[model samples]
Target: MASSTIIVMGVSGSGKTTVAEGLARRLDVPLAEADDFHPPANVAKMSAGTPLTDEDRAPWLDALGAWLAERDLAGGGGVMTCSALKRRYRDRLRAASPDVFFVHLTGDFDLIERRMRERKGHFMKAGLLRSQFADLEPLQPDEHGVAIDIGPAPDELVERAAEAVQRA
Candidate 1:
């Protein structure tokens, strides 16, 4: 039931990459990090602690969507990490692959900020988390996904996401 492609989505500090990595391993599918799809200009701006506008994200989203489409075309599936903070962005991805299912990671701001602070070498610093939260729109009822709490350890979170995908 369209569980082939899974998207681990949340704000910048919600442990999307970590959980997605584990999920991909658990699911035995390819995985992609949304950051890798960004253009140099976009990465430069974000690395400077600036929040990206929708305009800056469009092309990046398109590229990531295309990647999903390619995986789907191959008759297998994959997992990916994406901030997908807005519904419109998720919509763009869905357009590329209608079966795309999202695993929305959610947690307290305090926990997320602490996570962002502790992580190293990430372009998205702790300062931008507030902006991401401000822009975040939780998955609606119509969306094909579940909201997962990020309080548990990363492995636990991944397990929860994997279970959700199977159920989907």
Candidate 2:
């Protein structure tokens, strides 16, 4: 079974980063925040409460792909936190590394919005929650991914994700 490279995907407030970091730590792999791969233009647009088009996301996704490829070639892996809101976005990631897997954090919109509103020091503001949900396409059955509800405790979520990865 493939033992390397996982993408943690969800909308703005679904704990993608937290789960990714936790998984990376548990797996003893590096972790990457896909937000860091975003270009300045995308960040500026989001900061202005604007939703990014597919064009705006292509380069950022490509960068993520490159990072994954690099890590895989090094015979190690990393957990990357990416919104991966669309099917095409996930496809791009899979294309870069066929073995790449995704952990999809799922949660209720109300809960997510509430969390987003209370969160601070995050580039994605609460104002963009609706747009993010609108753009998100749940992982398809054929996709190399697993979905976990965030209704559980952080430790439970991480444990479930780790188990899923082990089985994947």
Candidate 3:
């Protein structure tokens, strides 16, 4: 099978990391957390309950793009997590790795908020959930991806996502 870079995307509390990790493990590929690619300033801002503007995300997106590009060039599959809240951001990722696929995790606001509150040691505060949802633009008809409801167990979600990617 041809190697494809898979981006597990959603708002902070939507279980992107957990799902991505499972997918990566199942696929036997490297996993990259988009949060780790953020610069200190961006992390600090998010930690302080501030939403990141497009400008603030530019460099971070570029870093993620580079990571995907590298994986593509090496003919290695991988999974990564990102908010990817806008069409433009996803476009940038596609530009970097044309074969990149997205698995969009989504859930109700209340459920997401509760998950965010329960998470510990994360830089993103629960207060930023509103901003994330406000900025999110769901995958469009033309996008190459799947949108999976984040209501199932993590293992089940990974299975669903893996099946979707296989179909893609």
Candidate 4:
């Protein structure tokens, strides 16, 4: 089997990190958190409860693309977390690494909002959730990915994601 890059994506509070960490462990690959790739300005803006514009995201996406490219060139697989709220963003990633696959974690607004509100020390505020949802585009039919509901526990969700990745 070819090495595969798995991008665990979703809006804030949708369990991207948790799922990605689990998948990384299950797949025995390194885990990259997209938040760490953000520029300080982006982090400050998000911390101030401002949603990032495309302009603000360009360099960040490029950095992530570079990471994917590095993995691809090395012929290794890994998992990463990203908001990837728009098709264009995912497209950028796919352009960098053709074999990239996505695991989109989704849940109801109320559930996500509660989670965000309870999360501490995270730069993303609950107020920004609406903007995230507004910008989100679900994975299209042509996309190589899986959409898993966020209702399950972390372990179960990882199991499902692992199974899905195998199938893909």
How would you encode candidate 1's per-residue C-alpha lDDT over 28-56 as one tens digit per residue?
78999999999999999999988898999
lDDT, candidate 2, 83-168, per-residue tens = 98899888898889878988999999999999898889888889899988888899999998899999998889999999999998
Candidate 3, residue 77: Cα displacement in angstroms equals 1.3
Q: How accurate is candidate 4 locally (lDDT)?
A: 0.93
**Candidate 3 lDDT tens digits, 42-116:** 999998988988999999999999999999998988899999999999999999998899999999999999998
Better of 2 and 4 by lDDT: 4
Q: Each prediction's Cα lDDT score?
A: 0.90, 0.90, 0.93, 0.93
Model 3 misplacement above 4 A: none
Candidate 3 similarity to native, TM-score:
0.98
- Candidate with the larger TM-score of 2 and 3: 3
**lDDT by residue (tens digit), candidate 4, 100-161:** 99999999999999999998999999999999999999999999998999998999999999
Model 4 scores a TM of 0.98
Quickly count the clashes in candidate 4: 0
Model 2 residue 63 lDDT? 97
CA RMSD for every model?
1.1, 1.1, 0.8, 0.9
lDDT of 2: 0.90
**Clashing pairs in model 2?**
none
